[model samples]
Target: MPLIYAKDGAVATFTIDNGKVNVFTPEMHRELHEALQDFVADPMIRVGIMTGAEGRSFCAGDDIKTPLPDLTPHEALEAHFFPHIHEGRTGLTRPGWEQDVMRFKRLKPIIGAVDGYCLGQGLIYLLLLTDIRLATPEAEFGFPEIAYGMAGAGGMTRLAALIPQAVAMEMLLLGERIPADRALSAHLINRVVERTGLMAEARAMAERIAGHPPVAVRLEMEVTERALDMTRDQAVDYAATLFRFQRVAYQGYGAGTGFFGTKHEAAE
Candidate 1:
């Protein structure tokens, strides 16, 4: 199998296992989407950890060795626009329109554990969507699309919001490789650990996030993602409403409706 799926308590793990490089193929794309959908539908799994097989890279990006899909214009539109709907039994189990990137942005949180080369479109999309990213010191990051006379798509457009525009442009325009240290300095990743400790660190982080109330975690992520498109004043009002709604809906959290509580008093 190109992918491995497992669940441990409230945490779900998806490991990419297509040889050492773990290059992305068409089948891998559909399998990964199915695995993620299974994770989301299961009420037991509250958090997810995405990593490569042991002693291998997270992903070396798209599999250039494999041939690209050849589809007619109408077929291409059908594949993109109506991936979820199928005409017959043969199409029933096909992967839906929910691409990995789309699934990554959904309700649950995901932690990315990167050990080696996290490069090209596949890795870049994952890196941007992951809530928290842990990488080894030797891990390399970049979008080499410019070298191929192309530009990064999908999550690349959101890079400027996450990191400095100059830094985002450097990778997008120059196709430059960013070392782990540089990525950390640019705040592109959350933490950098040794390869030996990367998975342990990622799992620990996922466990911590999973320990939180699932409703609260999902709503908080939704609010945060939505707030990115709002003005400061609008975001404040929107968050206030969300806080009230969450309290009413979940009720597991207190109903006080006071998000900040009393102001802190400085020591004299």
Candidate 2:
């Protein structure tokens, strides 16, 4: 299988192993969508770690060697107007996996371990899918689609949201690869480590997240992602509502005294 999904305790690991650089195909995208669905539905899985199978690359992006299928005019129109209708069918349109993955209503947090080339679709996944990221010193990050006369709309939009406009524009317009250290400086990745310790660090972070209250962790993820588009007052109000709901549903935490905890009350 090009994509491998495995579970260890509360942690789920997704490894992309298509080729030396782990370029994705339509089949791989379908597999990834199924894997993410499984992860979201499985109550036992609390956190996820995504990486390439080998140390060569996290992912180089889509496989250019794969031939594009010839589509009829009607099929092309269906592809544009009703993409999800072709979910089980392939070759007629670009798969809607990107939107499906990003709009997951109950997505668990995913940590990215990037070792080498993370360009094009790979960079898009890093920007939108994963919550925390670790990269090796030799890792390279960029959007190479612009050079080929493609806009790479997915990566460009998400990258601009994450980093400054100037940096995002430079990357999108020039198609230049950024080194791991440069990526870290730009706040694109969390840390730059040796290839040997990359997965280890990622796993450790996943485990730490898994140890937290699952509902609280999920609440944090939802609030933060949604808050990006919310006004400050709206964000605070939304968080307060969710916080109350979680406390009521989970019976609170921290020595059974609610989110404030006994220590906080004692100090008060």
Candidate 3:
């Protein structure tokens, strides 16, 4: 199995194990989609951790060795128009698989444990999918696709949103690898630690997140992501509505206990 998924308590771990650098393949993407579906559906799993099996790389990127079938102009148009119809077609190249994975709408948070190279599609995953990230001092982050004459728009948009526009442009345009410290300075990753303590640190962060109230955590994730595109007034209104809804649900279940106190206790 190129992708290994395991659940321990409230934390689900996804380990990419293809080759030494853990480059992604179509099969691995399929496996990841299924595993992610399961992870989202399982209410017991509150948080997720994504890492590479070997210490060499979290994921270098897609496997360029896999041959893509040549499509006629009409076939390309058809595939682009009706993606679901051509989804199962063998030998057909499925572009935007990473985008699909990132757009899964899973409210649960994922922590990225980056050890070595996090480049190309790997960098996309790190930027969009993972809420929190920890990398080793040896980790290198970049988007090398520009050099290959292919730049992923989704990655570019997310990268620009994550860090400063100038820094993001420098990375996208130069196609040069940035070390862990540089990445940290750019605010791309949370922390850089020794390789020995990477997973331990990631797991500890995951455990801390999992210990929080599940509904609150989900709402926090959902609202924060949604608020990014919302106007200030709209975001405030939306957050207030969700907060009231959550409070009502909790009170209906006779579980109004909060960080402060229950409504009745507060009234007293």
Query: Of the candidates shown, which would achieve the greatest TM-score relative to the real structure?
Result: 3
Error of 3 at 123 (Å): 0.7
lDDT of 1 at 251: 60
Checking candidate 3 for backbone clashes, the offending pairs are none
Clashing pairs in 2: none
For 177-208, candidate 3 gives per-residue lDDT tens digits of: 99999999999999998999999999999988
Where model 2 places Cα greater than 4 Å from the true spot, the runs are: 84-93, 96-99, 154-157, 252-268
Give the CA lDDT, 0 to 100, for residue 69 in model 3: 65
| Candidate 1: Cα lDDT at 217 | 78
lDDT for position 136 in model 1:
93
What is the C-alpha lDDT profile of model 2 across 1-268, one tens digit per residue?
Answer: 9999999988999999988999988778778889988999998888999999975689998898876565678876776666566655555236445555555555589999999899888888777779899999999998989889888654535777888879888988898999999899999999998999999899999987776766677789989989999999999999999999876665544453432333333222
Better of 2 and 3 by TM-score: 3
TM-score per candidate, chains pooled: 0.83, 0.88, 0.90
How high is the CA lDDT of each candidate model? 0.74, 0.81, 0.83
Output the better candidate (1/3) by lDDT. 3
lDDT of 2 at 80: 67
Best by lDDT: 3
Clashes by residue pair, model 1? none
**Model 1 root-mean-square deviation:** 6.1
